[model samples]
Target: MKDWPGPVSTCWNHWIAVPTGDQAGVMEVLSLSSPTPITFAEAQEVIDADAHGNPDDRHHLSRVFVTPEVDSWTLVIGAWCNPCDSERHEDVLRLCKALSARYGGAQAYYYGEQGDGSAWLVAEHGSVVRRYAATGELDDELLTLGDPLPQEQARRLELGLPADGDPQAASSEQIEEWTWAAFHLAPEIAAAYGVSPFTLTREAKVRGTGVLALTPDAASHGI
Candidate 1:
């Protein structure tokens, strides 16, 4: 086992994590095109370049990068690869299902600091196991799937949320509190499910290599 120098902030906003070292398999599942192996340094360069108007049609509309193998997990990063950006739980479940079909399991997370929102979804063997999201801008549940994860259940209990979310029985302040709990849970939820990319520290074991790839959606358009 070896320690990573540190984690970069680019992945803090959105990322999909599949528990596997097979970067090719993850890229294949994503339908990514023209993958070129690159170090984390080069991966950061690709992201930075795309941000400053790299003017390369090769990436089409977005750039997606895969992280070097981190222990048993490989992370995929891109704004287009998120539920927070879409504000759609279905997108998270769909992508997780696709990745899980090939990788056995997948976890997707999103955190929008400006929006003060966060979302997380877990899928396994082609089925979504759980999903949750909150932006604090809606009264209705933005999204909730399956059941609460153990850590979530514990958090809810600690915060006094009942096992059954009966809004009818709760007061306005209580509802607001619960809604607040929903935001900013990506890190905790991710920690419980798998690796939390942004917080990865020296203790994490990394191997193989990462890469930059053109997204399939963009590449298919002949860019």
Candidate 2:
């Protein structure tokens, strides 16, 4: 994570922390805050009514929205599990890398473990960000506005996966399977928008270029 200089504003204020099991209710609050008063049951109905079908949709509903207090505006998503843990950390890292490469750096932000066992990635361009952990906190400073994954780390991320596979190699069914696993393993954030899961997996390969294409330029050695 890139270090901020001084007393940054508080972005945590815009974040609405919901209980582990209250994701549906929270989403309802967000969705139904208009003229109509939506009750918990009504919100569940709307979620269930989606055409894609809900196969345990509850797991995909965990998340909070953060509005930053400083110049570098951002929304931070906390990781539900320890990012260093072999289980889902790699997936989180991969997604951040792809997002950074696609957006040209500083467009997204991610933090792993440090302050808390939380990892969050933000894509400010879309006005949509996802958080998975219960303890993730938001900083007040919105200093940089591009890729949060540094050049060095981005280079490593670009080399971590294969780039020559078939574009249609992973079928939707296969992708769905991985999505299900991701939702279950980290049941604190919603992984899908429509039929797509927010996090990318080996099987899905949603971000096109693959590992090699995303890598940064080699450093020049000075004599």
Candidate 3:
């Protein structure tokens, strides 16, 4: 059997982290003049330096690996999780919008579903492209902007299989199968997004597109 690569958190999803301080937090993903992107060590320092005792409120950070066209840095935050709360889901959707507005892209991948109902979000150039259920089904109508950009379409076709075809028609089994295949190809997808596959697989790459593509072990430490 080909063993899957890494921790469940980083291994299976893409993510980003930002401060919870509203505008201040918003600036982290975007700045007026395009400030220098934060390094992985800098992001990690922030995470390690966080004094918050609560796991959910803790600051977890990861370097986004992406092409230069997509400005701004991305990190995966460790916010509190409230299962079955539509309000919580809305809160995240709002954040996704904010990231899209300020920067050009952002995304979040919950470590696991647990009480939460879904796990992935794709936002770009100030709008949400799609949202997916925990089982990888793109069923939620919570935020559907209709017709993603050409770049978004290309990336979706490349990275998100099965679910991307017709999220509404995807079954749980199909979603699971896609997840398995996607995770196994995480390194290849990461490379397509710009980072080298070998570098990402070895955890040597620090930057990547926010949840667009990622190293399998990217979220392991912060989570």
Q: Highest TM-score: give the candidate number.
A: 1
Best by lDDT: 1
Q: Output the TM-score of candidate 3.
A: 0.41
1 or 2: which has the higher lDDT?
1
How do the residues 147-176 of candidate 1 rate in per-residue lDDT, one tens digit apiece? 877766776676677755556776788777
lDDT of 2: 0.26
Give each model's whole-structure lDDT. Answer: 0.70, 0.26, 0.38
lDDT of 2 by residue, 1-223 (tens): 1212121112111112211223223223233121232322332333234212342442212322221212222222222112332333444344444433433321222222123222333333223233333232332122212332232233223433113212256566544443333222221231221111122123321211101000011111110
Worst 10 residues of 2 by lDDT: 208-217
Clashing pairs in 1: none
* lDDT score for candidate 3 against the true structure: 0.38
Query: In model 1, where do residues sit more than 4 Å from their true spots?
Result: 1-5, 10-12, 45-61, 87-92, 137-142, 220-223
For candidate 1, give the lDDT.
0.70
Instruction: Rank all candidate structures by their lDDT, best first, as comma-separated numbers.
Output: 1, 3, 2
